[model samples]
Target: MIGKKKTDATMILSSEDTRLGPSFVEREEVYTPCYCEENVWKLFERLARDEDEWYAVVISNPSRTAVVLEQRAGSAENGGLVIWDYHVIAFRAIGGKADLVLDLDTRLSFPTPASTYFSRTFLPLDLLRQQFGEVFLKVVEAKQYVREFSSDRSHMRLPDGRWQSPPPDYPCILAPDGVGRFEEQMSITSEDVARRREARGWGTVLTLEEFRDRFL
Candidate 1:
């Protein structure tokens, strides 16, 4: 029952569904580990540009390992191929029972349960440690990750100051207005999380298995 949702559940899950609380817009992309960092940062830049109050975030396994999700075999209903390496998602507390997790690339509906999102993406913590050593998985919430994607300085520059690549196309996955609404939700501060982390004694390094057990 943890991952399984009833058929009727799907009907109620939409980008505009109030039951899921609020929703966020996400850009569509062919994800790959090689470019996931840039992609996620780009997404943050997009969100920040559209909504100044939104935070830029990156959540990943301690190892920063990348996993492939092929559309041919693992497409979300939206037909997106996600190669999640340090996957990016948005979060804001909406006065609901819990925080809303907006992961538009998933097979499940947008704004699904955080537990469901983690279950689908992150590998087991124990396995990660075995392969990558005592790395601590972390959540990085930065006040300024990037400028607006449409800004003149938006694209990453090369050592010579040349543009790295063309700016990303407007997000094609969901409406921008819907995604920006989350910026108004209660803030989830780093200090708040740190206090909980200290009380829980998870240490700085958290393995994938441990994270799954604790969060999922």
Candidate 2:
């Protein structure tokens, strides 16, 4: 792992950090070190400054199955931000620094392994179907599901590059208890899955079956 130390010039502390204690890393905290049109990274930087905890940033493209890992020291310059780009498929540790390294894709809210603070955004697979159309299904092809698919089916692609099809029979399988899978599947449309799910009254939007069940 690349080690960094905190630099006085870049840290921003906040009260949420005190209440959450060590676990208070906001989604935006780890994002600051990276460059993006949106200043999403600033959120995490603020948390790092408040909590005084180190973080790792993983830039990923699941469609390409590629990820980059970098170590940021809590008490270092640049908010101890580090950026590493490489083609690694699974998790691995660097220089015996952190207990683990998490590969965060700011597009999916998957549970990362323990010992590492991973930053990943939740991109509902169902919504992906609506957005990328055909390309969206590639993410499912890239990963193997543990609980979502009732069959050992290995691969599928989305249609129209705008919406991904739920497994032929498993659309509602991811729904909350009492919610029919078919009904839930039918409820999602290409135009609306990305909107705030609470407004639509859908339970927690759509979640990957694997992470939801802790199968992975």
Candidate 3:
């Protein structure tokens, strides 16, 4: 079941850039399968053991939001055991085979008007490429992650001049090292996010869909 919510159209600005990032909600639409959680965890655990390759697990929220568990092999840049990002929608897990009610799509649905509201300005994948550059794409490709997130997704300006997941969320996980050794660069405090936006100098707000079409 998808969900629909009102679009306030209020966006968070970046301190490093004038562009408005993705919008935030007081509460996110997220759910996990009670029965499959353990099995899913096991699958992830097994994938994590390999130090020469990368693996991931994904989970999607009703509103096109996806969570990714990115595990990568160690590298000269990092020690082994690194888990970069955990909530990447583009690689989230949706139920395909399970015992009870085998469908994850039903449990996940948009919230009506909210879906319509976003549809008017949905973000495209191309924009993400432009904003983040090859570094981001390389990781996705390296992990062989699937596009579980929406085919169209938006990005937020991070404190570092780079674009990243919006505040109150961990979008990308950078694990130069193998699983168990990871570093998070995109997360920020609400105060920090606000401060960064002011630092960058912003003029207006744009929806994910709007931004993708305009700049990306």
Give the winner by TM-score: 1 or 2: 1
Q: Which of the two, 2 or 3, has more lDDT? A: 2
Q: Candidates sorted by TM-score, descending order?
A: 1, 2, 3
Q: Among these predicted structures, which one has the highest TM-score?
A: 1
- Assess candidate 2 and give its lDDT: 0.26
User: Candidate 3 lDDT, tens digit per residue, 1-216?
Assistant: 011132222223334221112321111222232212222223333334333322222222112232111112223243222222322221111132111111111212221122322232222446433542111111122133222211111233446665352222323322233232111112223333234313221121223333224323
> What TM-score, over all chains together, does every model reach?
0.42, 0.20, 0.19
Please write out the lDDT profile of model 1 over residues 1-216, one tens digit for every residue: 001021112324445433422232333542322233345555554444342233323443323343423122244573343333344445433332223454434455544565555565544547545754332343334233332211223224568886454434544222233342111111223443345334221122234454445443
Q: Give the TM-score of candidate 3.
A: 0.19
Given candidate 2, what's the lDDT at residue 48? 38
Q: Which whole-number lDDT from 0 to 100 does residue 34 have in model 2?
A: 22
Q: What is the C-alpha lDDT of each candidate?
A: 0.38, 0.26, 0.24
Cα deviation at 115, candidate 2, in Å, is: 5.4
RMSD (Cα, Å) for all candidates, in order, is 10.9, 17.4, 20.0
Give the per-residue lDDT digits (tens) of candidate 2, residues 90-132: 2222232322222322222212332323323223456534653
